[model samples]
Target: MTARTFQATNPATGQPLAPAFPVTTPQEMEALVAAARGAARAFAASTPTQRADFLNAAAAAIEARADAFVEAAMAEAGLPEPRLRGEVGRTANQLRLFAGVAADGSWVDARIDHADPARKPPKPDVRSLRVPLGPVAVFGASNFPLAFSVAGGDTASALAAGCPVVVKAHPAHPATSKLAAEAIRAAAQQCGLPAGVFGIVYEDGHELGVQLVQHPDIHAVGFTGSRAGGLALVAAAQAREVPIPVYAEMSSVNPSVFTAAALEANGAALAKGLAASISGSGGQLCTQPGLLFVPVGEAGDAFLNDVAAKLDATPACTLLTGGILNAFQKGAAGHLKAAGVQPLTQGAKPDSGAQPQLLSVPIAQFTPELADEVFGPLSVAVRYDRLEEVTPLLAGLEGQLTATLHATDAELDGLADLLHVMGTRAGRLVLNGFPTGVEVGHAMVHGGPFPATSDGGASTSVGSRAITRFARLRAYQDFPDRALPPELQEANPYGIWRLVDGERTR
Candidate 1:
């Protein structure tokens, strides 16, 4: 029998792209996982400096092919050139940051204590360091095709943490994923890393994802997509003989709060910013401000109308796929059909691209449905009559990736309740800024609590901390100094900060 195959198409024109891949069968997948496991031991044994070399080479290789990748992403993911280029830059930055983490060596989280010869129980010499957790399985996201794809944060972090990785390519942009994967493979070969240190599965089968999670060799998983998809991976991984950590960045409506004083001071700018954020990237961003809470009165009147006018004037933009566009439309239409929700702007949608939409619901009529994420250029504004309504409304929100507040210095004092509410509900809080674009740095957080993510976002899938997800801790008791890993040695040759005898020292 002929083997099954998968094809990728241009979302804009529905044209096929190059390099169709045969579907990897269940038996083939097992073999692939086995190969990755074989490579993990050698890859983990290499020094951090050696791993950093691979990450730098991979980043350079990916950047060198930026033009070709941007073109493929344009066709397959319907992203504009500037956005795709920025995404490429973001991915490269993440790689280099992980490289720096390896060079610095502190990511190992080393802790050591000399043998307590005279202690009550006589504590032996115990030295512990973070170590790789075998192979990792990464699922590429449909949106941010490059930054979240083959050579993206998950791959970079796993490699940085000395773990082998096997990526499951997202079907929406199969050709783009293949190109990125090739660059990573080239870097691995150039660095003389073990075979199968990096691998990609191009099948468009649901079973492929489940099989990857259930694979015994895969010690952890990283994902970015819908709530349903993330949960499925979580469920499959836990049913395994050895359940592993799953860093799944899922749904968030990212609410922007507009205090009466801030709106009065900068109503026009807030309206414009909200308008740009709603339509940004066709609202495909997980951090898109899909919900807004505003105070009623004169300030609210002007802010709502101004936002409506700006949204009505914005042009249409296409989403990543037909499925996403349809789901977005259904969400917006559902709000229109619901009670007490009125259209702020009734502009018609184009046949291809999504049009900006704004709907308003009264505070008394606001439901959990009002806070649902509409993955297009859409937003819902809820008008509160009194300050009392603000607490209950915010309390009803699910854990989010971001919660924005457009408040002035004086307004902050009056918002003690709001400050406390948002602190626990979101991973990041924005002050007088939009949340559509996330900065790539050590302090940045791109994950949150459930339904926003699985495991309540204890670990991030981006930046330096991401490496910890693919690593486990190991302790050596009563081991000679000569036997210790360099990071945990008494001499501290690596010069990294580590906890020594209950104190932080080099």
Candidate 2:
């Protein structure tokens, strides 16, 4: 029988794009997993410098064909040219960032301890360093076709950690995912790496992804999407005979609190900034502030009026997919029906697209449903009587990727308890700023506790630290210096930082 195929739709035009992509069958998926397993040893044995070279090459290849990627993403994702172009750049930069991490040699967290013959119980020499976790299965995200999809942060970090990667191309942007996979494959070939070092499978449904996660040879999984999707993958991975780790970044409302002092000081400015953050990219961002806490007074009323005005001026845009727009509409409708919830203002509503929406509700009537993310240009402002109300409300929120606070310097000291609560509820805290923009760097934390990420915020899906997720520590006890890896050898041939006898040294 012939295999099934699917076409990506142009969300802007409500039409499917040409060049249907063949869906991967169970047989093909098995072969891909087998190939990745076959190449795992050789890929893991490769030197960090070799992996770094491959990563850099991948970045260069992607940049060389960036326009093709941008164009495809624009049509498939219904994103503007500038946003798509920026995403391509961000994807390339992520690869290069991991390249630097791969070359550094310090990320492995090498540690060594010398033998002590004089002790009552003789201590044997022990050296330890991180090693690859073999093959990894990556699920591309629908929203971030580039930055979090194929050849994105997860792929880069896994490759840098010396693991073979098999990407399940997102159905939303198959063409873009295909382009990225090709670039990475070319990089692997150029670096003399095995053919199975990287692979991509096209599929639209959950069966293939569940199969990939359940494969015995696949040691880890990386995912980015909705809460339901992440939890589904997590459950599948857990059900396997020998379960593997699933680093899935899921939902986050990214609540922002506005103190009375801050609202009084810059009500208009805050409103403008908050409106833009909510409306940007049609509010598809994971860190978009979905919930806001504002003082219940003239200042807050003025701020809300300004925000409504700004949102009214914003234009409606095509969402990444029709289903997403439908979900947005449903979620918004549900919010409007909730007790004490009233529509403040909304953007222009087109025949087929998403419009910005602002809703208001009293703090007393705030329910759990109010905090749920709508995944579009929609947010809720909860009016509070005093600053003290925010602490309990923030504490009640689920684990979030970010929690922001807008307060004056003078009020910060008094709001220390609230800030502390925010820290516990979120992975990243922003002061006097919105949470839509996530920086990619050593300090950036893209994962959060619970529903925000599957790992309970223990791991990050961005920045240099992300590589550690694809690795496991191995200890060489009483092994000869010659038999040990270069990073853990007595000679320290890698010349990287290592912990020696509980002391950090070079």
Flag regions of model 1 displaced more than 4 Å. 348-353
Cα lDDT tens digits, model 2, 1-506, are: 97899999999888989889999988988888889999999888888799899999999999998999989999899899888888888888999999899898899999999989898899999999999999999999988999999989999999999999999999999999899988998998899998899988899888898888888999999999998999999999999999999999999999999988898999888998999999999899999999999889999999998998998888886788988999898888888889998888854222324778889999999999899988989889999998898899889989999999999999877888998999999999999988987888999998888889999999999888999999999999998888989998878887899999999999
Best by TM-score: 2
Error of 1 at 376 (Å): 1.7
Whole-model lDDT, candidate 2? 0.90
Q: What's the C-alpha lDDT at position 295 in model 2?
A: 88
User: Where's the lowest-lDDT run of ten residues in candidate 1?
Assistant: 345-354
The backbone clash count of each candidate, in order, is 0, 0
lDDT, residue 395, candidate 2: 90
